[model samples]
Target: MAVLAAIDIGTNSIHLILVEVDESTGATRQLRKEREMVRLGAGEALKKRRIGRKSFARGVEAIARFAGVAREAHADGIRAVATSAVREALNGREFVEAVRVASGVDVRVISGADEARLIQLGVSRGYPLHGRVACIVDVGGGSTEIIVADAERPRFLRSVRLGSLRLYEEFLAGHDPVDPNDYRRLQRHVERALRPLGRNLREYGYDVVIATSGTALGLAGADAASRGLPAGRVHGYELTAARLRALQRSLLRMTVGQRRRLPGMNPRRADIIVAGAAVLIGVLELLGRTALVVCDRALREGLVAEFLDERLERASQSGDPHAVRTEAVQEYAVRFGAGGEHERTVLSLSLSLFDQTRALHGLGAADREILYAAAMLHDIGYYVAASSHHKHSSYLIRNADLRGWTPGELMIVSAVARYHRRSMPKERHPEFALLSPEARDRVAKLAGILRVADALDARELGVVDAVRATARGGALELEAETAQEIDAELAAVGGKSDLLAAALGMRVTIRALQVERDVDQRAVAGY
Candidate 1:
């Protein structure tokens, strides 16, 4: 087991966790935990500036305490991050510098998308996520992280500034003027800002709605305990479609003091819990999810889990480049909903050609990895935009921040995706030249392999089951073993051979082979 510590300094609180993780199985157990209610958003609304002296000091003190917990745990690594309050405030830099000086911990200020991605990572790692389209909503003090995922992979991720602290500062300013008109106005603003998001989320219809963060978990935990449910299984705690509506009405009727005194309600969270619940209710209604499942894990656990998972994957990989590349591509293909057999066939063929023509292409292991990745993710862009899908693939590969991949490796994958169809790499293209001379050469070579492989799966079906490559004289022969001869796939492969020939300086020969009964035949071609 490896120990990793994560500290999250947010607008409302500072939290730390010491997690003991089993690297081989991706199992995580929390050893120790600590949190402080710093209220870093205090007076930000009245001042229209940032967190003031008292709040900043409170945050620094919290960090100092967390540093002690991390050290005592003998943590192998520690990740300290700050969210919306620090990112939005003018004096955030000063506050972060203070924490660094006081606690010797560098704080990473994360963007909203980064926050949402991390939140999803944490929740998915902690839960049993199998074949469900999970929509995770983390309603925090300064931001709300909304991530829509299909099982273990993220589909749509976003973060909004509609949070408990922001709402409290805007509407619940003074207790005296908390009139019905003021409440109605706040409601209209929230509904309007959410309308655009609601419209865009129609295609990504979610099956299970998972709520995370302290406030969301508290609501779900309290509600579940009220109904005589299990304790920690608050995660995936179901609030039925009808029950949730009633809860919303009940929450709106209760005052802050009344909420504090309610059974299972945390006194510290009573003031902002209403605002958090409102946002979650809005998202649930918009997404048409019948029940909301609460997740106890979120951003902090995500950071630790990621570190643990990487260590495990590296240990399992055992330094085989081919194994590592294949594992990565296979995981990605499964996550992105690509046909597994089709990807395997394409990869087998592309790698064979790459190895056979190494002298012609003059590429290395890295280049081969790029080719495999491009083959696996060739259709991922279809998930985002279809018209200019190649370009979309390039953008996503470049910017998605995939783990275990270097920037140089990502560039090669992006270039391969870009050149798979329509346009080829130009002399003046900016991203193309960013690669080193050796990498550029590898990109051109691997792009040829990707183009041919992707074209072979034009129908997006698992027709081609196997492939082989052979070098005869000055020609390269590719033989594909198929259950049936896919005419369209062959036509597509034939069209791409001209470009492949121009780039690889060789004649391309392709042929289909047949099998009898269950016996698989070896694809054959000669030059």
Candidate 2:
């Protein structure tokens, strides 16, 4: 069993979870977990930037404590992610640097889009969705993530800056409010901002609302207490739309100090509970639902599930010989920002080119996997730096703790991507040396397919309709259909025919086909 720890550094809290993974049996179970509300965004909220004083110190202390616990738990792996607060802070680097120096932990700052996806994943794990269209709302101290998920996945996901802490700061910026006008005005603004979600809500035809984050859980706790409910039973608790309205009214009547003393209200959340309740109230009213099903799990669980899924797939492929090559590559494509359609176009061309000369190249499952991952992650380097982007892409893929990929698998993907551009696999490259002798040879063989795939879409249009492999004579024929004239693409391929020829022992011809109209490109890309 491999023990893995995931640390989530949120604006309002820091959480650590330790879990043991059994690779042999594909079993995972949590061992230990701890959560602390540090309010890392406390001072930053007033400055509109990160203030590396109290928040930074608190974060470091929390991490230090987590490190001791992780060590005692004997964690085999560690993964840390920073949420909206750190991402928005101008001096966020300083805080991260301080934490790293203090606790020896590297933190990944996930984008808001990624945050939304992870939150949805976490919510789904705790409460499996029954309805096809569901709205996932995570109201945090610094940001609110709303995901409109369909039968397929999230259709529209957005993270708004309307969090409880921010609202509290705005409302209490001055002296104590003389009347309820301040709270009412904040409610109106929140409703106005959330008006756009109605468009997607109506479009998706949603039937269920899923609520996550501490705010909802706290609300559920309070409501449960009011109704004489038992503790530790609110994970799947449902609040009817009407019940939620009544709770909001009761909470609104309390002052900040009063809210702090309420049952289930954390001392750290006293000032922000009102604002969080307001945000949820707005969502409830807009969706025309009186209650929401509260889920205790959020992004932390989502991240862990994603990690587990990746590890499970990797283990499955290791055990089975017939696993699909596209499984890993498509995931790589998603992390690399490659368009699904383009990746499919590239995959089709790559496989077509590989199949035509399999007799000479002798491509195996592992080789095919390398080809697919390379094709999927070929453009990831563009996100970091465009200049000499092939090297950048290699660096990013090699360093990224991509789920479902081992260090060796990441090396192959990186090496394949490295050769996707001008340079071929060199014997002296560090990444090439890291692979086993068999893998190094495979990388060289697979790089030929990647180079060809990269050149096939030289025009960057979704025009490459289909690719076919035909070996009639001593030569291999690569035939593809394009919507428009692909002279540049052909020219690009023309330049790389020799690399393919050298690897496959025969010259390759690139041709444009005109007789294909049956294939669904969308399905091929999993879109």
Candidate 3:
């Protein structure tokens, strides 16, 4: 069992969720949840691309208090992420450092795309997408993330700069009852932002539209209250477009103080509820759907799901660490149309080389796994274009949402694949430079091995059944067991062994051994 806390610092508020996870069964129970409206992006913060002094202080204080609560609960781990507000602010890193100093908690500022993916992960826990393609929309304070996905994976993911607080502050603030002109401008802004998303909706139609985050929950709660239904009972609630329109109209006509007095209303959200309703209603109309399913699970819940997933993955690593990673890599390779016998042959050779050179490289099983994944995916860039396919392969590996691999691991794997054919890891290369010194060294060593393995399969005929490496003094000699002549493969190795030699600080040489055809055939068959 493990206790975990996830905190989401947003433009309008900061949220915390404490979950107890059963490690053996992979079950999670919500222990507690908390929210505080700090308006971190209040006033001209978003407009100016900075957090205001007051908002910054409020955000720090709230995070410190939340950290205290998590510590009191004896959470095994706490993960905090800041969304669009801090992500876009110029001084966002400053705020993050301040929170770290005050609360002793590290905060990760995620990209809008990652935020969308996590939201979908969290929503899947509460509401199953089943076999249907569902468009999950998270109406956040600084941005809106839309993901079109099914039971398996997401098809489309996008983050628009439209949000309740963003729209409210940009167009509807300072108005008692929303000005008709300002309302029109807000609608126009929303329409423009959602136009591309609407195209996706038309292209990849959804079976259901799922809405998440506080804005959606508040809108659903308000709709339920107006219909004389139970209050705060909005989760899994199917809020219809017509009801949302009705509520939007009512909100536009009422003052903030009046809206605050309404039953089931959250006074903190009163001012921006109108804009929130507008964004949701726009999405519903675009989908041509009657209603949206409300999911209270958003970024914070997504964080919890992620924590549990990582924990479960770690637990599995003890038994068979490569099982999940291999599956995820193979799945991605197949998806990109890069899987075949040639890739299999290269993968086999890469692993053999990685295992054989363990003493020289001083890399462990984990590094071998990294080499395995990179070898399987090194040619994936051919899916994009044969020219500069290596560069394309790097991009795909970095961007593809492969499970069981952390962001850092993905970087290393991608770097290894990238350098399999092209230039070595240089400090000038942006992607290589971004990696830590340790990761950069790992990539260099692994890529050096992968290049030689790939070269051994240069003909894609798997002629070289196996290679035995001998390290003598400062030079390494490879004996290739094969019946057929391998002049081409030998030449390929000569060109590719430069990296390996440089990485291992040794001279490298390879030669093929010609045995009886029957004996060679037996060796190959055994391999």
Candidate 4:
């Protein structure tokens, strides 16, 4: 088992969870858990939309302390994420950099929508939620996240600036013992804000409602304590709306200090606990649910699950029919700003040629996959430079850390993409030298087809529709199926047929045959 640490720096608190995890399945047994209330979104920083000096210092110190504990536990990796508070803060990056230096950990600030998704992942992955349709409600200090998802995927997610701290500051700033009129105003404001959910609740009906974050858990903990139950046995805790309203009523009549005296109430959150309760009740009313299931799992567990999934995917990289490898290869191409339409065309034409010429090359599915990936990424090197981008393409393809495909397979794809344009493959090329005589021959034949494909789409206009390669006598005829006369494409075909001819040991011919229009928007262009 690997030791993993996940740190969640929220607007109101910083949380660290250390676990010995099985990375492949994201299964974990918790080792140590820590929380520090720093109120990173408190006071003037909220108005300024930035982390204040005191809060920033506190934030850094908390992360450093947590990180130290994680390292002391010999954790394999630490993922530190900052939520809504840092996202709205102008000085968020500056504070993040300070924390990085102090804690040796880079802080990741996530959007509210992403925050909701992570919370969903945490509940689904970290806890035993099964595969039931779940509506998760996560209430933080600075914002509340509402998500409708199943056990596996999120269907809808929303984040609102109506968290406990925001509600306290916005509607009940100076109210002590919560004036009856002020409480009514708060309730009306909450109802109006969440009214939009009536449509979503009807559209995506949920099987069960799950509540997370300190507010829901704190109240649940208090409820459990009053009933002589263990507070730590909070997960899967079920609380009904009527019972929740009873607790909210008790808090409404007491001052913040008096509320803190309640069992399971933390002194730091006593003031805004009523607002948290209000948000939860608002969600229950909107969804017409009687009870909510509280989950101790939240964003921290989500981060760990996501991190492990990525690592497992990359470690077992292959062009398996699952296409995980193909997806990763495309991500690299997109990352470098390759033209989409051109890449698709080249890939289509090259694959078509590979299929039609199957009798001649005798390459396996694995090699054909290498050719497909190469065609998709042939021109990505243009992001570095337009001239001789073929060389750049090879370098990138050879160096790409794709999920699937071994080093030898990567070299073949890179080599084929490298020779798509200008120069012919030679004995002295180091990348070519790495391949065996048989593999080098395969690369040359694939490169020959790619060269013709790239030339066919030189204009970046979607002109050619279908392509076929036929063996006739001592020559290989390459036909372009198109409705419009493709003089430019044919002319390009003439100039780039030398490599094809050499690979096939015969002359190559090109012709355009008129055909009906067949176009796909996603199939516009590729090189």
Which candidate has the highest TM-score of all? 3
Off by over 4 Å in 4: 23-27, 318-527
Residue-wise lDDT of candidate 2 within 190-239, one digit each (tens)? 98789987876666667788888778877887788788774334656787
lDDT for each of the candidates? 0.70, 0.70, 0.80, 0.79
Tell me how candidate 1 scores on lDDT: 0.70
Q: Count the backbone clashes (under 3 Å) in each candidate.
A: 0, 7, 0, 14
TM-score of each: 0.60, 0.59, 0.61, 0.60
In model 3, the runs with Cα more than 4 Å from the true position are 320-527
lDDT of 4 at 326: 57
**Relative to the unseen true structure, what is the C-alpha lDDT of residue 109 in candidate 1, on a scale of 0 to 100?**
95
Lowest summed lDDT across 10 adjacent residues in model 4 is found at: 518-527
Cα distance off (Å), candidate 3, residue 249: 0.9
Winner by lDDT? 3
Name the candidate, 1 or 4, with the larger lDDT value.
Answer: 4
Q: Residues 287-374, candidate 4: write the lDDT tens digits.
A: 8899998876789878876776676567546434334765676567657755244565676677778878888877777777887788
- Tell me the deviation in Å of residue 92 in model 1: 0.9
User: Which scores higher on lDDT, 1 or 3?
Assistant: 3
Displacement of residue 202 (Cα, Å) in model 4 is 1.9
Candidate 1, residue 161: the lDDT equals 78
**lDDT (Cα, tens digit) per residue for candidate 1, span 1-527:** 57788998887777788876533223244566667777788656324658878878888988887897788888888899999888888888998999999989999998999888888877765554434578788888888888888545688888887887777778765562244665666677677767788866777767778888777766875686568663323544666657766765676677777776766666677777767777877787788767777766788877775675566477646875544544565466456554233454465567666767777777776666677688766656665667887787787778755556777778778888777877667767765877777666666777778778767766544455555677788887887666555677778888887667777778988888763212211111110
Q: Is candidate 2 or candidate 3 better by lDDT?
A: 3
User: Residue pairs in steric clash, candidate 2?
Assistant: 239-291, 240-290, 240-291, 241-290, 241-291, 242-290, 310-404
- Model 2: how far is 421 from its true place, Å? 56
